[model samples]
Target chain A: MTAIGKVSLRDTVFQRGRSKERSKLLVFNHTVLLLLTAFAVIPLAVLLFNSLKTELDIGQNPLGPPRTIVIENFREAWEEGDFAITMRNSVIYVVATITAELVLGGLAAYALARKRPPGSDLLMLYFLVASTIPVWMYIVPLFVQMRMMKMLGTFHGLIIIYIAGNAPLTIFLLRSYMIDLPSELEDAARVDGANEFQVLTRIVLPLTKPGFLTVGLVVGLGVWNEYTLALTFIHDPNRFPVTTSFAKFVDRFDTNWALTSAGAIIILFPVMVLFLALQRQFIEGLAEGGIKT
Target chain B: MAVLTQQKPTTVIEKLSDEIWRKKFLRNVIIPWVFIAPLLIIHIFVVAIPAVQGVYMSMTDWGGINPNVNFIGLDNYHELLFEDKSFGKSLNNNIVWMLFFLTVPFILALFCASMLAQIKRGGMLYRSILFIPYVLASVVTTTIWKNLLNPKDGIVAASARALGIEGFEVAFLGRTDTALMSIAFIDNWHFWGFLMILFLAAMQAIPPVLYDAAKIDGANRWQEFRHVTLPGIRPIVLFMFMMVAIWSFLAFDYIWLITQGGPGGASEVIATQLYKNAFQRFEAGYAAAQGVVISIFAGFIIMIFVMLRRRGWDI
Candidate 1:
């Protein structure tokens, strides 16, 4: 019970005071976070909830729980809405475009990273500048070109366009990741009697696998969900992507909430799965690519 | 033995020169060209050729199908700038859209990200939930909201009435005054998630040591935020601002699908205008001119951003 004991007691009281303040802060933080979460999730919840309700129920009660589950809406949306075809087209478009983008984008990135060739810096600058220009600027001329070349309504044309359109960002991301790789690895490979091609194939490509995966997943997600270009270029129903097909539900019919909601749910499932499967890489890639760029 | 050794040295020099020539040919000439060829070919056909043709088409009166197009220089620009009344309104709407789209969400995202940074649990869940809207295509989002905002029996209207707000049953998407704003709000809801994720990522990039130092210096949360977090995310904020501005100018999908610039051309932005002019009205030349105008504006905004970035603004 000396001076040291008294000081320790005072410190304990001060800590209690700090704890109280922290508790108050914590409550405030939680309230704000809860509000944000609600704000973010309400629309999705509404979509899901309404999809389970009949049209009469949705119109009459609006926000109340469904009187009965209606799984028929999804069946209707799938068959009549041509969702099967749209899904097939979407898969084709995404796979073809993503594959092309990764190969071309990765090769270009590898060359630029290692060679430091003359005007390589200028090439990178060109991509940066090109990214800022709106794709709409080229839409009309592209349409005309496609029409003239008899490539309109062809999957090849759309795939090629998608690849070229997404190339700038893909290359930019891969190059940034490539720049961070250890130069010594390439030097060591060269010392081991590897040519430039061997260095790229055996060493650089293998090392940059993470970057490739990140770019592929990101680009795949974008192409899968793309709408406007698909709407514009792909007029044939057989070639329409998921977005265009879903849009048809709205265009042809009145406000059939059940079917539209079901379509939305179907459309959302893949993207959600994609994000869930690659959540870590996606988040990391987004952080790295976005902040740096 | 001396003569043979001397000859060996000369022969070795010749072989080395030949090897150098072959390596140089492969490395300096072929590889770079090979690496760049695919991209260059695609660019030339898809981007460069169309760009040139788009400019060419701007001078003509092509209806997008006819082979023959009468050259009509600057007439489309004249109509858009001077004669067309809706064009001016659309332009003004675009300005408002750009401002709100870039600023409000950005400020809100920053605030949310900052608040979330103080929390320990469920941060990733919140982030993923917010980002859900961004992953949905514009068509799906617009469709869902259109149904939700239905004037007569839509959930939003019903809910508003349930809360005792009179006249909340108004046809939000049908009227001119509210249509643009309503569309903008939906766009905000759809897009804010991405911005939140960006801000959150940028926030995480900030070192914890800065906050620790600020705390030791007797800074409270708000003060530390102002002194530390704001400065840390300034570059991202600036970059997002520029991007949002560009996106606003180019935005078409949601507006098109939701309202079709309708209730008589109320929510039309430049991109929508270009689309209507080209596809609906069959004014390909006029649309091309409008496209050029949009491109020039985009070019101006990008130039400013690039100049600022060069001056260390980080965008």
Candidate 2:
């Protein structure tokens, strides 16, 4: 759009007098960015700080650094809120749902991506339209159906819902991944006396482990963090996942800010660790998932 | 002659084996369908059939658990339109929430993203820190804010007391006037960071040459942002706007967790109202109608996007 010479254009970034002005601009940029960053970060830090404080200390210094560093809140929450059992339940849901979504959705995605089964276009359109169907539209009937089938208050029931909800995500992402893969090896395996099942398992699955991993992470995080369905379906306290249970736990211990913060941190700890460890992948996957929505 | 006949017999055996090996029943149809059936059946059971069932349920007066359903055509719709006060209020609140989200997050994200875009150093630090809130669960996010907004010991009250700012120590969530705004503020705190990331990515994708071009034209920072940044990121921004508007109707977790749409139905939204009707009130048919309405609102937004695309708006 500009006829300026390339070197001059590049030089414009720090042109003599402009360097001082640019530096000042950089300071302004950092100040605003840092302030906004603080707006995001401070609350989390306070959550963490409050989690480690005594109830008395928090009452005195609610939003500030804790006067006493106490680790007892975590123990109290685990004991009182039943984090031990809830965490296990959450893990089971996450694992079962992710596995179901990946295996089943992967098979379907492979069929649609490469095999192009009859009515693939129709199936694609179904998913395309279904993805936009608000969960509220169907959730009531789904609940009714689950109730009729005696599936309400079950982990498997919730997992089934999670898998169904994530199918579009799994199919779209995995299909794209399958499409990207050079299919020469799959063909070679087919020629080498392998069945379609063998080719997928021995070749496609292995080579596309990254894609499966991404799907697993995305779906796993979703199921783990899910609330509304878990709230609706799993009414029994014994089977409540971390999210639903922690919600009730927070409300029950509403006055106990320290215990509440600790419980919240416990719920967030694993996700935060995984997020920080694989931020790029997490961000990429979230962006991908968000884009689809 | 006998040897020739023997060869013909062997050839016939070979032909029979080949026919069995290439059965059309298994190749083009059965195997592919096998791969597809599981996902299709599960999806149909969970989403499709139920969604279809919801259309029927919307017309009936069936409590969720009741086996008997009385079909009353468009009655729920009639009541929703004419008689439902909470529904009307919830719908209005949803619109108000949508307006806040559409403006507040967009402004904050655009400002923060543009600022981050200008500087290279520590951008990742700022980006990741800013994004941390977004990754946290709604329960956790709301809990953090609930403490931060606590009337007595929370940040606002503490700060006011410290700074001698009189009459600023109001119980934000407890007051009907401030409850919805407070919840929106908390939700926005957890939300705007996400939009910032999206905007930042879009901004970064804008070719530097465009900025150089703008600079060459003697465009100021505001002018450059208006011309270059806005045009470059318009698609994502507008798409996100549409989504936020749709999502406003479906807002549940934060409000449900924080207030349960309480303090005089102040922050009640469509999804919350739907939940209450379906489960709490046992008005499944009414809830189904509400759900359909929420879907219609969402579908209308989607339809607008689709129509705009069809009209060659390029968004």
Candidate 3:
């Protein structure tokens, strides 16, 4: 790497005199990138700053850094926003959806990728068409159906919807991954007196762990950040997820910027940490997921 | 061989092949379906059946409760198309939203992606930073922007005061004139970065040798981009265009969370109208019609793209 770097450096040095325009363009690139970065980040910085400020401080220094750091806004927002309940509810929705989606999606993907059963292609086509259908198309009838089944305002009900809503993406992504895996290991495992289930559990599962992780992250993020279905199906405040609950909190305290900022931070904190920690997975998975509701 | 009692075979080889076929049938067909059944059943019930029911319900006066028993055919659609003024306004707003999204984000993302592609150093860092907003929940994004656009104490007010500019601190989300566009701008802010990252990925995949060739041929940066980069990224660009056009019609969270289609129905879109009609007005049939309308619009966009593809557009 160092040798390659040295060679590139020497090449740049040799080309520097003739390619002054290149350096000028680099400056222009950095300037525009910096401005775009600021455009993306400054509002978030202000939110963080306002979260630390008091109402009085925000009144005076609204978009600037806080004059005094008041840690109590988080405490106040936490209690007032009922974040304890909402956060737990969101986690339950996310975790349950991921678990169910992985198990069911994994099974389905494995069958599609390896077994190649009759009509599997038809099923794949079904999911592809189903995925393109907007949620608005079915949300009203689904709400009535959920109500008829007495599943409204319930965590399991919401989880079931999330699992189903994410089924297409999950199956598509996991099947693509499983399709790339060599089948020799499974054939060898079959020779070792392993059943199909055993081959999947022991061989395919471990080999395709990264696929599961990617699907898990994408589905999990979708459930965590979901708003429309949560708002539609969950009328009970106590059962509300973080997204819906935060919207309600903002509604009640639209003018209280400090408290709202702190509330926003509370909701954002976990997502941000996870994003920064596993940005590559997050970015690639979401990009692959594409236009999720 | 002795347990091959399920089907009678006249010959030994016939029995042998029969046994193998049964085994393959069990292992391949039944088991796979079993594995797929749980999720597939649930998805079919949740999405498929309801979607089909939604089509039927749009023709009925279901009223969202009491299990009403009337099937009035196409009346709701008639009302939506001819009678409902708000639906027309909302559909118009959605078109405006679609137009803005198709143009602004594509141009912004393409320009920035090309610029970022030129840089070798800190490209990853810049990409990550820009993408941070996309990872954020819509709730959090709207909250941040809502405060920043607060006419009373927002950055606009503060900066305008500092610069001695008059009449600059307008309520962006308050007035009917600006509410829809302001919300679109905020949504775009959280959104365009994702598009930039996507375009950047596509740009990176164009093979550096193409750029080298372009440079060797005395091509300027813009010329190289126009010819090499754009053509290389055409498929993804076109695919995203269709997806964005579909999503623009389905856009709900940003507008709902920010304005709730308020300030005199300024930012209302089809989905928002559908939501209110179903939940608030208890007009399930009407809303289902709206939902179908939205789907028709999306399907229409998709069909156009399909037609383009069939015409050898290379999309």
Candidate 4:
């Protein structure tokens, strides 16, 4: 009886010790995570704070809370910097490029996924090779072509260039997703007397909405943020995209930190909202398409 | 008898003709062509034309603005390779940038991913916060860092002063020696978050049973990590490594905005050099040649990646 009681007592002590160790570990983990979170959040918070303060306040008390939030910085930035035009240009460019990329990219992807055409595999390989090629090499030549065609400084030209540059990867990603779709569904559509066009539009397109959304979001973000091509091709200020316009703002020696930061924040808001709204689909798409190759 | 035979023969020929008409050629070929034509036109006009033009431009002596250009065979390539001192410096900087940027972030990300994988609570929050920097425009990122790293009245300098390091200010971005490293550090800051999330996702996809088995075999944390986590994430690590290598070679925005290839061209990467030659100097031909060199280097690295990929590193 005494031996049995002693054994139980020992077991209880050991269990307590293990529980204490586990709690310690949990605390340690939480502390580390909090620290990391602070590190990540601090710089952005500082930027926001600076954006709200006048430049003098920023120079004086960099880390301190703003004495008075200057709400007029955004208004000033919009008017003086012509950010409204820049924003419009960004929207137009992103929308046009994404639409063309999706339609064209989707068609190519469907062909590769469904048709199994002769040399389709070779075409796919060519795309992979093309996607990895350094785009800077093509920039000068593209510039020359745009000049020759009298398309430089035109929105239509920018759209064409953006679509062409982005189509290879977009097609690659869309194709992968389309290929994963079950063949049985397509076969059933054919059995129902649906021709290839009907199958593509009615059946495949509906099912691949997620893939389209993913491609659209990624490509849109890239086109919106692109600077080099825009800077090179769009010599006219009126035709400048948001990125090139922002770069011009920098070059003008305009050190209005509040306005600059406000503009940055404003530019980022849409992308942030889009990401938050479609976080799941965006992440899944990136995981599947980006990591696969 | 003759009328009955002629009517039967005509009916047979009409039936065969109807069957042939049903195999619609337009449906098979034209429809798909209609769908594909837009992308094909854009690709041929924008991408292919320019790419070919870039090659031709390399062999000529063309100032970008001038309509007239002299065909000077191999002169631009010869100058870039032999005469240009800055080109060599840019090449060296690119190499260093690739090494530091690829290895440091990769290791840090792996560690962070492993730790995050062990935790269950607040995982999504951690991931979102980490990925915030990557979504910011490069211009914004560079602007913020420029202020942060300023020699006078910058937050970092002020903090150092507060910590009793009197007059301990470093013009990191302005100095030739430290400029490249500073730019690299900023690049890592903006990038590490995205990589961490990627690695975390990869880590989470690894099965828990592997760790359970390792523990059952009397393995400790380090041993379990080696036996389970390392092997599980090897492919992801290799893939990310190659991506970092490629991206580092292509690094431009931060270097361009922050340094502008300044402090005696210490931070002049290949991309920036290419830009300067093409745009600022109006040496379109020379820039094209430099571009070809850049492509060759990029192609070499890509080939290595492809070979490794083909060897079943990942499919």
Choose the strongest candidate by TM-score: 3
Q: Where does candidate 2 clash, by residue pair?
A: none
DockQ of each: 0.40, 0.56, 0.63, 0.34
Candidate rank order under lDDT: 3, 2, 1, 4
Tens digit per residue, CA lDDT, model 3, B1-315: 356565678899997898798898899999999999999999998999999999999998888887665999999999999999998999999999999999999999999998888777788899899999888899999999888888888987778988999887898989999999999999999899889888888877776667666766878878988999999999989999999999999999999999999889999988988999999999999899899999999999999999999999998
What is the lDDT of every predicted structure here? 0.80, 0.87, 0.90, 0.78
- What tens-digit string does per-residue lDDT give for candidate 1 at B1-315? 354335443587887876676687678557866886797578668876787788888888899987877888777778879998877887888998988887788878888888777656677777777677776778878887887788887767878888988888888999988999899888888788778888777777777767667866988888988998889888878877777777778888889888888888888888888888887888888888878877888888878988977887654
**TM-score for chain A in each prediction:** 0.89, 0.93, 0.95, 0.88
lDDT of 2 by residue, B53-80 (tens): 9999999999988688899999999999
The Cα error of candidate 1 at residue B120, in Å, is 1.5
Which consecutive 10 residues in model 4 chain B have the weakest lDDT in total?
Answer: B1-10
lDDT of 3 by residue, A1-293 (tens): 12223433553776676467676878999999999999999999999999999999999888888887899999999999999999998989999999999999999999999999999999999999999999999999999889889998888889999999999999999999899999999999999999999999999999999889989998888788899889899989889999999999999998999999999999889989999999999988888778432
Question: How far in Å is the alpha carbon of B235 misplaced in model 3?
Answer: 0.8
lDDT tens readout by residue for model 4, B249-295: 78888888788888898999889988888878888888888778878
Pick by TM-score: 2 or 3, better one: 3
Cα deviation at B11, candidate 1, in Å, is 6.4
- TM-score of chain B, candidate 1? 0.90
| Backbone clash tally (model 1) | 0
Ranking by DockQ: 3, 2, 1, 4
Tens-digit lDDT track of model 2 for A1-293: 12223423465555775667666877898889878878888888999999999999998788888887999999999999999999999999998998889889989988888788689999989998898888999999999999889888887788888888998888998888898888798889878988888988898888778788888888887887888888999988889999999999988998999999999999999999998998877777777777775
* TM-score per candidate, chains pooled: 0.92, 0.94, 0.96, 0.91
- Classified by CAPRI criteria, candidate 2 counts as medium
